[model samples]
Target: MKSSARSRLADRNGPLIPNIDIARPRPYLPRLLKHLFHPVFAFALICAVGCNPNGESASGKRKKERQKTAVVEQRDISFSISVAGEIGPAEQVSVRPEVNGRISELPVDIGDKVKSGDLLFALDDKDLQIELETRRTEIASANLEIRKAKQELDVADQEVELDLRRDSITRAKLEQQKAKDDHARNKILFDDELISKEVMQSVESAYELAKNAVLQAERNLQLSQERFRKAKERARTNYELATNAVLKAQRNLELTQDRLSETRIVAPFDCTVLTRSISAVGQAVSGSGGFNSGTEVMTIANLNEMIIDAHVNQADITRLSADMEVDVAVEAVIGLTVKGRVERIAPKATVRSGIKGFGARILLISVDARIQPGMTAKISIPVVSAENALSVPLAAVFTEQEGRYVYVVVDGVYEQRAVEVGVSDYRFAEILSGLNAGETVSLEMPGEDAEVKEMPAEKDKGKRG
Candidate 1:
């Protein structure tokens, strides 16, 4: 009956402990293990050990019981703020054509270093050349017209001189005087009755004829003078017109030459090509106009001088000023560092990356060839620094209604003392007064039961007053 009951129990439940042979001597067992062999009892034990009313565990409680303190000592303390910036050339320029034309020759391309006056690209000059020849031809034609007008002017002057000759008028006057003498002598003979009436009448008629001839000569001379004046004026006007045409043609020629020269674009300074927009030869570009800046052919920059554009946090901007030296590290180049100086700071604040900051430009004092534009870099700006100053960990300082204070350790007791603080950094604060070197201060607030006392600094101030 006992063997049947034990088999039924073993079948109903899984084995909790390894089974021992009944034939062999029974092994010794620990009392706890013997009790834990019961499944219900083992589960209760685990619950009692792990479950607690307080949230903290055993290790956490022990860690809280330890007091944290720091020793005040004279040490070198410094603080620096770092900001990310982008590397760029100090002087960058976008090259554009001044006159519209197709690019014929592109000598330099992206990444090419060029000097001032070096040819960068050229435009198709065949059309401009043909236009230039046309302008020259116009100028030559104008010169010929000018020469023809000058010859006509000379002829007009000669005609005026010839018209001024008094030969016909003088001959007419001489004939009129001879006819008057003959008329007078014939009248005297007729008065003496020694001449025929018909002869006298003929003499009178001759005198009248001579007078009409003189009048005609005078009118002809005056008419010729007027005609000569008009001809001379017309000739002068034609000459002036010809000269003006020549001037206009010359100006056109100069304009054509200027346009032709614009076909060849050259570098304005020593620079590196930052970008190239002209992909191939024969790319047509437009000239700058009233509303257009023209097509950009390329971008060049003075890579020898570089600058870092960074936005400094508003909290740290006040501590920075122009000409302040800083350290720059390139993100792309490992272990590369260079010196820089603050060149300018923005007068107003701007938002970048959801952060309000002031723009700052740092000129790289030490330029490296590997440093390229658009590369990201970090700039370290020194804000506050101290050397060999009495300092303590920042945690030791506390703020309350009384002011900044630290809990100093004295004779195994906590002393609440007021402190005058100076410059500070992330991990430490410089103690300007009310604290001395080789002093011990608590990092955390002391318990209420701990012996606490106020330092005699207040009393000392009273006595000094």
Candidate 2:
């Protein structure tokens, strides 16, 4: 009965019992708890000691902290700005033909040197020559006509003078004959009855016939004089017309001769032949007014007076002014740099949609023998610069409500430094004051947690006092 009772009790408690091995030691909970609490307790004690208000005077302690926080360092810096540009000549010119013609004679080729007045090419002048000859012939004919007209005018003038003289003499003779016939008729009328009526009638008839003859002769002479005057006036008009025709013909002939001379192209100035499109002989060239008008027979340029034509951005043009110094480098002649200046800026900007920029041109200050026309070049314009100035990298400078400031490393602590700035470039800025050369400045400062505390009111009062 005792054993059964013991068995029943064991079964009832068996499900509730936890299994354990004698060889394995139980987990040390007390030890783990002590280990965890040890660090926490120590941290609390540290905070308590640090926060003690009476241990150290706040002002003295703050002063010590300030000393500890100040930072100091040293660095090297430079200030400069960079802009792109290109090299160009001081003077350059483009050469084109003045008259249109095919090239009959081309005396030079590319790179060939030529002097002023040198013949470059020739055009076929056959038509011009013929036209000039025709004009000259016309002038000769007009001149002969003028001479003939002058001779006719002189003869007409003499005939007019002779006719006037004849009119005067004949008029006087008619007047004398009329008077005599009147007198005879009056004297014979009274005696006619005695002398017989038939005889008197015959005398009167004779007188009348004679008087009519004299009058007729005078009228004929007057008509001849008027005819001579008209002939003289006609001759004078013809002579004048012939003279004007001769002058016009001569002028036309001269112009045609000039056109003929222009057919032989000549260099306007010393230049180099860049191209020759014609041969020496058998090449037919048309005149200026022909179908081959404006055709290029050859090309010439003044290579010695070369200029670089470069385009700069419009945004940068405002910073550029005339006479500003520049440096140029030609790709064709590498390792060589030429000096130049800003000669001019375009008033109106040229918008290039592809690049979304405008362009400007700069003139080279000087020339070099190696430089040639059409050579590619690069230019560097210093928009701003400083020498031996107190400067720092742009990153080291920052703005504040007070003004521009920099993080100066004062005795190993970052101290906010107020700085007056001057000229600055993209990479650097000139620090006018509050910083010295060789002094270290921070590019960045620690975050808010690392911020230095402000002094208390009492400390500030003492400092003011």
Alpha-carbon TM-score of each model against the true structure: 0.73, 0.64
CA lDDT scores, all candidates in order = 0.81, 0.60
* Candidate 1, run of 10 with poorest lDDT: 9-18
lDDT of 1 by residue, 1-465 (tens): 013211211211221111212111222345556776698977766666588566555445555775478898877767666789999999999888888889889989899999999999998989889999999999999999999999999998886554444677888899999999999999999999999999999999999999998998898888888888898999999999999999999999999999888889888899999899989998899987536999999999999999999998887798789999999999999999999999999999999999899999999999988899999999987756778878888778775545567888988899988876665665677776777778899987777689999875442220111
lDDT value, candidate 2, whole model:
0.60
Error of 1 at 21 (Å): 68
Clashes of each: 0, 19
